[model samples]
Target: MMIYTPKAGNAPNDAFLFNVKERSDRLMNYFLMVYFVLGLIFALFYGTWLIAVLVGSLSLIAYYSTKLALPNSTMYQYVLSAVFGIFMAQFIYQMHGMFEMHFFAFIGGVLLITYQKWRLQIPMVIVVILHHALFSYLQNSGMDKIYFSQLYNFDVRTFVIHVTLASVLFYICGLWAYQLKKYNELHLSQTLQMAELQKESLLLLQREQYNEERSTILESIGDAFFAVDKDWVVTYWNQMAEKILSKPKSQMLNSNFWDNFDNSTNSISYQKYKKAVETNQSVHFQDYYEPLDNWYDVSAYPSEKGLSVYFKDITERKRTELLLIESEKKYSDLFQLSPLPKWVFDVETLRFLDVNTAAIEHYGYTKEEFMGMTIRDIRPVEEVPKLEADLAKQLNKDELTKRSNFWHKKKNGELIEVDVQSRDLVYKSKKARLIIANDITEKQRYIKAIEEQNDRLREISWIQSHIVRAPLARILGLVPLIENPAESLDEKEKMLEYMLQSARDLDDVIKNITEKTTITQNFV
Candidate 1:
């Protein structure tokens, strides 16, 4: 029911005005053409070709003049009104005051209303009054040539009455035209306002829909969210906020923010919120709330309206992080206190990242020096190629652990063999391997000595079993021959000589055992 008023100088209304002017111009041209045709018909009825030609020429001029004038100009409307009046007057003169021709003046007045300019009708009214009074007076004063009617006597009273009546009728037509113009203008203004109102209503509806969708999205998020105005009055509280804060939205809305959460004033959460609002910036932090006995990751965003806060419970995550840190500390202690040499090195560059106390003592290098050096620096020069190949194989393998026996050089230039146990893991967020080296140089040397001792022992046992036994068996054979009484003295002497040979063989075996034992002792 409201009457919508457009803004001043609205461009759409300006365009509407131009359109109305153009349409009025076209209508005026059409009416002038019709009026010219009517003038022609009247001339033909009266056999006045001059009048018809004059009227046609004037009509053409008026039509083109109006067309040439700017549509926005009121001058064209006035010119058009005058042209219509002149054409009608010419038709009336040719018809000699015919009532039908008189009616043409009223029609012209009505047609002028299409221009929607009330002042334009004044020209037509003036032309009608002048035409009727002057022509009637001339005809009554015996001016026969200009007489338009011969059927009635031309008396002064009669002429006055006729002119007066015609004047009143013309005035009435002019009044109607004026009222019509006013109505058209009002209608055009109202139509333009109605269209603008409809467009604004549609825009408002779309804005409301967008806000509703945004609200739904905010409500659906898992994080607790709330908004406060510049006055610190709560304006919005999502469902998650209600659940996390243990308060309903009905109690939160329009409530003072500090009144609801008084304990938070001295806390980091409140400080961050205040800072964000004061600086008009976004703040993100994690803090523990004593009231809830929980940690929260909070973010505050400031806007012209005020501040909005989003928070989520992070107590579980914090506890897990603490446990992980403790576990890493225990593992670090074990690694550093281990008796065997241990180190961590980058997988890509093979540079040592960390080393235990045992590694520093065994490798004869300071921890700082080890950190600046690569794993290859500790290996003997001759084994570097094999080390590179093994490293390449390890890179291609998905296995977590690898073992290899590598000869390493110490800081004193002493080469020691080591059994390396390497396990792959992430160290300081980088791909790296942890190496535990078991120094096996002494063990390998002892193993070799034991092997040599076993060989010597086997050789001694073989000599005692084969060579010693053969000599003893000969001796036993000779003793039996020498002890026999039935045998002759020469036979006994020969047996004694055989016994002496066997004894010599046994002595040589004993000397061989003594010499081998001495050599084995020296080797040991």
Candidate 2:
């Protein structure tokens, strides 16, 4: 395998310190210019050509000393530049005391303490301190270089004081550098550890995001989903499962599945799930009712460690089944006890599935013996040829219902007139027909009886209105002829009037009877 590396110029983090580097370079350049100006000022202050030459030479060295481009140079390069600049300043001050070199050395030592080694910076500090003390002693000692023998004193105390002060200054510089180095090392280690912790934290956040996304998808599905351990404790419960079972996941999950629950029904689903786990086999269950309102089809499959269960509500399907059963029961009872004959037949096969009690009686067959028989069996042989096409038409249509008059032959070969009403229906998962038949063998006799009663009432009404009333009318018309033929003819007139009143009463009775007969005919 080969590796690819980004070119340095285009690498993004490679320019991380570019602005800092630029600023650092500009500041260093400014410092160089300041060094040159300071050297020029010191040379001017010397007020002599040779001294000015010496000062200018030192100034040039300080200005150009750090102008090197080394990519891998350590911070020690900065320390070295500061040392050289300080030495140049020392030379300038030596040539002319217009500026204090001792104070400049102090500033250089303070800067060197930031980067230089403790042991190394100590010796430099001692040299600067010794130079300071020697200068002071020389100033106070004498006006000229008088001979030591003539001086009568070596000034041992003065020498001792100068050495002691230098030693103390070196010791302080060593201690300062050592403490700074230790502090830098400790700070660097802590910073690296903090960066590593941040990386680990970011990885954990990504893992959590992935898990949350996965869980959201699972909960959005409509099926109730759950998982359990080998011991049958609930491990996971999805949102649908919570909604269907009316149980909160916080209270139910991780608990024993058979524990006391808030379910409306103590669901056998939980029990069946446990059984599937114990048997280590998958189980499929159908048409199980949780309550009057809840029905489910469920399956549990064994997993390596436990079981996974899935189920969906089938309440609508179960409700439809119950409605069909109730409808069938209502019609079955009516057919069995009804006075009129009735029969149920399979439409496709045209075979009888069942018959009511009256149908069996009228057809002269037992209930069990009549089942599985065909409609043609009880029909007249002459009618069978024409019946095939009619039955076919009935079966072919989506819904076929009609009333017809047909001839039926009894088991003993007696012919009967039957009024039949039939409709297509489904029976026991098969297409069938429901038939109700009324035997009309005595229908004409009943009609004749009603007609006779109606005719007699009409005749009586005619006799009362015409025969009886006409005679009464004739007697009233002859009332004037018989009136005064005898003494007291008024008495005969009263007797004729009573006969006319009797005739009127008979006519009223006839009219009432005729009206009642019409109503009876309508009811029949």
Candidate 3:
């Protein structure tokens, strides 16, 4: 911050005094020059070369002295006034007491009053009195040639009257000078006071403007704000605070805080406020308010004068948090109580994160053992590379679920085929997968057995359809020939023998069919 210091010349009454001194010095110099000229002219007329030189020298000295002494010397003006008085006296004496020249004495005395220094007039008055007394005595005491004035019979009465009149004029001039000096001093003092007051007023205006801007910023903020004095009276309540509280500032300011809010003494917000004030520290918390059916995030700051509070309505955020918690609970229940053998494993490390009861029982591993093992531990060594490739592909896809068949090893070292259905998920803030394993070992065995039985049954059906028909057709042809009436004895004997051979072939075909059926049954 910059500090303001009034200039030296700007000090009270000094400017006026300094200006007067400058003007007086210039005026006195001019008067001295004129007096010197007049004195020299008079001396020349009277043929007094020495007096002319003396007057010229005195004039030069007085002018230079006043010019140099001004501003620094207070007595310079009075000294100049005395010098002018002496000049007048010398001029009158040189002119043999010309009364007109005596009048110059009065003029010089009156002119010195312009300096506003009554003391200067005193020196000029003294010079005039002494000049009058001495010159008049000389003229009256056998020095009549030295005329003091136009009235040559220079009596004591005339001298007294002249001196008295001069004294009265000097007195009046001195009084006026004194009063003028006093007036100047008073005016300068008042001016200085007014200047000081103006400076103070300007400072006050700046302070007020600063405060107004601060208040504007506070009012424009998004958060609710209020302040209370030590007496618990509301001192400041901003627009946001008004909206949050559903009350206007006009109704809140200057009112007791507790009275207006009607909060219970045991309320969390009330307790927080009390704690902040008692400890002279800042307090922050979130709490639900029953009156407004809302949640608020509040902060209170305490100072010597009072406490300031800032708060925000967080009811919507609170409700969202509650809903999320409920959703998480439901998900946890589903994962834990599932009938399928379900487990979760970290995607990056492939370490088991969690396993359901079904997963533990189906895998034949304790929960603790499962937690300590990775997904690769449950897969056959030959299938690990396939599992890795599948996982690598899964990493590139955001698919919810993936299905694959793999050989899995149980805790008893038994290898079984499993159909694994897995989905991506985040568990405990880490990328992971949830898996449900369907054991297909028994079902696969049953399916293989049924396939073998179907193959055997198909072979038996082909045999019965082609081989049995060939044998039966031969037997039928031979028996018909043997039963015919037109046949001779040799032909009948040959036909009967052929019929017996055909019947034997049919019996052999029947035996083959029975053996195939027996084999088909054994396969089933």
Candidate No. with top TM-score: 1
**Quick one: best lDDT, which candidate?**
3
CA lDDT of 314 in candidate 3?
Answer: 97
lDDT of 1 at 373: 98
The sequence of per-residue lDDT tens digits that candidate 2 reaches over residues 23-84 is 44555456545654555565564544454456545544544443343333333334443443
Q: Write the per-residue lDDT of candidate 3 for residues 343-434, one digit (tens) a residue.
A: 99998899999999998888899999999999999998989999999998988987888999889999999999988999988887998899
Question: Which 10 successive residues of model 1 have the least lDDT summed?
Answer: 1-10
lDDT of each: 0.82, 0.66, 0.84
Residue 306 in model 1: shift from native, Å? Answer: 2.1
Q: Clashing residue pairs, candidate 3?
A: none
Which pairs clash inside model 2?
none
User: Which ten-residue region of model 2 has the weakest summed lDDT?
Assistant: 145-154
Candidate 3, superposed: residue stretches over 4 Å from native: 1-217, 228-235, 254-256, 276-283, 301-308, 346-354, 366-374, 425-432, 454-524
- Residue-wise C-alpha lDDT for candidate 1, range 1-524, written one tens digit per residue: 11224457776655665676778767866776777777677777768779888777966786576656554345656766777778777887788776677677777777766655556667877787687777777876777668455546567677678667766766666677677657766887898889889999999999999889979988999899999999999999999998877879999999998999888899998888889988888999999988778898999999999998999889999999999999999989999999999999998999999999999999899998997899999988889999999998988998878999999999999999999999999998999999999999999998998798788788889999999998799888878777888999999988888888888998998998898788778878
Which is better, 1 or 2, measured by TM-score? Answer: 1
